[model samples]
Target chain A: MGTELVGGRTVLGTLRSDPPLTLRQTGHGTVHLVSTAAGPLGGDRLELAVDVAPHTTLEIASVASTLVLPGNGESLTVVEARVGAGATLRYAPEPTVLAAGCAHRMVVRLVLEEGASVSWREEIVFGRYGERPGTCHSRFDATIGGVPLLRQEFVVGDPAVDGSPAVYGDARCVGSVLLAGPAFGHPGPGNGGRPGNPRGHASVIAEGCAVLPLAGPGTLVSALAPDAATLRARLTWGLGRS
Target chain B: MDAALLLLADSRLPAGGHGHSGGAEEAVRTGAITGPEDLARFLRGRLTTAGLVAAALAAAACELATAPGAAADQAGTRPDEPAAGAAPESAWRELDAEADARTASPAQRNAARTQGRLLLRSARRIWPSPALDTLAGAVPDGAHHPIALGAVSAAAGCSPHDAALAAAYTSITGPATAAVRLLGLDPVVVHRVLAGLVPDLTSVARTAGARAAWERLPAHAAPALDLLAEQHLRTEVRLFVS
Candidate 1:
């Protein structure tokens, strides 16, 4: 996937679709990920690449929650994105549900150039209703101007560790929103008169959710809840969207 | 392992480590760890995630401190002459920034730096090495705890692997000790839990030490622990600072 700015409007440049994962342009500067196939079943290797050109804005979202089902072996998905200088990328995907007996790995690498900004959100649901989750390893690496911004990986599956208070506690869902760039009060090349609140102070929003301002120009809103609804609600609230 | 490495791992180092519970206090309060078994599970999860990250950082820091020309450069520079220190100073700054990137939570970062500042203070007086002084000059506020530990370990004649071991070991031992204090768990049983974790601890340390590149260090994150660290800070009355 690629985007370019034409006549002060963002336009799609190149979008190559593969099986199971397809991209649809829903509106100007907005794209929705549509899953054409049923399962990213075990042993599947999927990759998605996104590039947003300078001065362009792109918003990518998903149509529905991803269901990871058990299959022959482990499944892997990698999404790599680059936002060029003065560009913006907003990636808000639906929650991924880890079904019982399935093993899935999701890796997202996002690179932002100087003056670029991103609002990336990720959510994970342990399992379907009344079912125990399998294993899911999620890794997110974000870098700005060749420096590390956020590098994190989470593994959820083992009952002992997942249920521990130091991990998931009693929460069946976990989520985080990473807001980085000059738009989020991070010092960059230029703001370009973008409307962004400079108040990036850290604060607790709810019972198990908090907004953490990074040492750099970024903010992370993290939350855990008993269910997907509550998790989304808390994350939304953490982002001040609710 | 060097004997001084044991000193680095000991809880009674006056590095202000006792004031932090590594999220065990929050886990206990949430009833996620109600018994010795639960505590054991929590420690294991932490050892793999946060512990591994810290171990890798410590190992990387130690490797940088002991790299060819680093010692010589540090030896030629005065504590106040950070500009004259050259490569080593920038290297330390980069490692510290990497630590900041790995830590998503402000509260956790604050806790790590607080511990780092105190550890640097004590290490300077005890080991008194040019490398440690260079690190202090590089990061006036503080280096992350793991970075400081690695540099200090080098000054105390410990290898990078030893620094990794110390980091990985302390990550769990501190929480185990806190669990005993917070949940009133049997000290003997907790010790048994720690003893059982030796194999896992060694393996984690080995993996961490094997990686020499600081940019590619382990970045495993425990979401519950991050949330707990933030939530712990908001708690009106809590035993641990983080």
Candidate 2:
């Protein structure tokens, strides 16, 4: 994380990781998050922090899909990020696959200063190869000047999700994209001008909302699909404009 | 079991709740809920996810309203400027924003606001309170339904748990009633389904009441419901507002 910036680059930044949790700087303002272990096993805990200073940008990605295996315990991931004024942070991680009998909890908190911009996506697959989905509890809380831009928590694999038409329905894949600040005037594909009529059934959640403008500050775009490929395509479409 | 809770939860309380089906109308139209069994599952799903979220929010609001100095917090209040001369409860706005963030569908958000407005109108007459006036001033377009319900519950002397129960009970009862109207399902059978869910409903209320922190309140998102609301909004022959 950067405490200051110089010459349009991060002046102070640091990265720390434990086993199976490594950070690799792939390019200028870009980092590839890699895990050495086969994947997240039971009882694993991971923490990450990134700080983008003014006039700098940071992009985060994962090397491959993170596999969540069955375990007697649960795993947790907590990420804290700060996007400074005039800075940008884009986080697009690979999909996470929840295998049967696994329980995982993820919490992400982002603080954005004035003029900061962020474009992030999170994709989840219930299970791979037709297996039943495991349990997952994810919470995202973000703010600007202490005013809430987004506060959301989702639980999967509960009895409520088994056959709820109000939830997943028949889709096994779900994802969300968040675009905030003045930088995203309408980033991706689609006619960002016409109030966005999101359609197309086969791939996206037939009933999922495409793009939604928030009350005070941000925009949230969410989608549901039958598989990762469809979700990825839709996310890419959203990312293009953002 | 409080009388105030019952009154506030009553569908006939002139809240304009009858106009929206809570997504049941669209679900029925799409054949997602073709019979009583399907309707039962739908209600169960909604009760646990969205229902739980609403319950927690109502409970949180009730706590805020019943706190010490809540009344004097309301000073010079007029019809158009309600929040004026009032205690600065930034938490109220944050909770409202949380509701906005949890609601992913534009149609759903509009529906919730409409119902909230109607509830506020009815509450202001039924139970006169400066807190309600302050809320009205704060959110002229209308606060979200759960927020209004919580505030009204407090004005009516209901506990946070009572507010949670009221919120959770209405979350499903409204839709169950909608299903009966839309599909001509036997009211006897629908009531039976609701009866079977009594235990779960009570559990949900208790769980929601136990959570004191607004940020810790549930933020479950139902993609299917979000999609259905969006689809319902676009449908020309829709009978429900959402």
Candidate 1 docks with a DockQ of 0.47
RMSD of each: 4.7, 5.5
Per-residue lDDT of model 1, residues B131-213, tens digit only: 89899988877889999999988888899899999999999999899988998888999999999999999999999998545
In candidate 1, which residue ranges exceed 4 Å CA deviation?
A186-201, B68-87
The CA lDDT of each predicted structure is 0.84, 0.77
Q: Write the per-residue lDDT of candidate 1 for residues A172-206, one digit (tens) a residue.
A: 99999999888565342211122222653355556
| Tens-digit per-residue lDDT, B1-242, candidate 2 | 57877778888888898888888999999889989888888888888888999998888778767762332232211234343343334445556766876775667777888888899898899899887888777777678899889989989999989999999999999899999989998999999999999998999999988845565578877767877877787679977787
- DockQ of all predictions against the true structure, Cα-based: 0.47, 0.41
Pick the lDDT winner: 1
Listed per model in order, the count of residue pairs whose N, CA or C atoms clash below 3 Å is 1, 9
Query: Candidate 2 lDDT, tens digit per residue, A64-114?
Result: 988887665898888899998888889989998988888999899999886
The pairs that clash in candidate 1 are: A186-A217
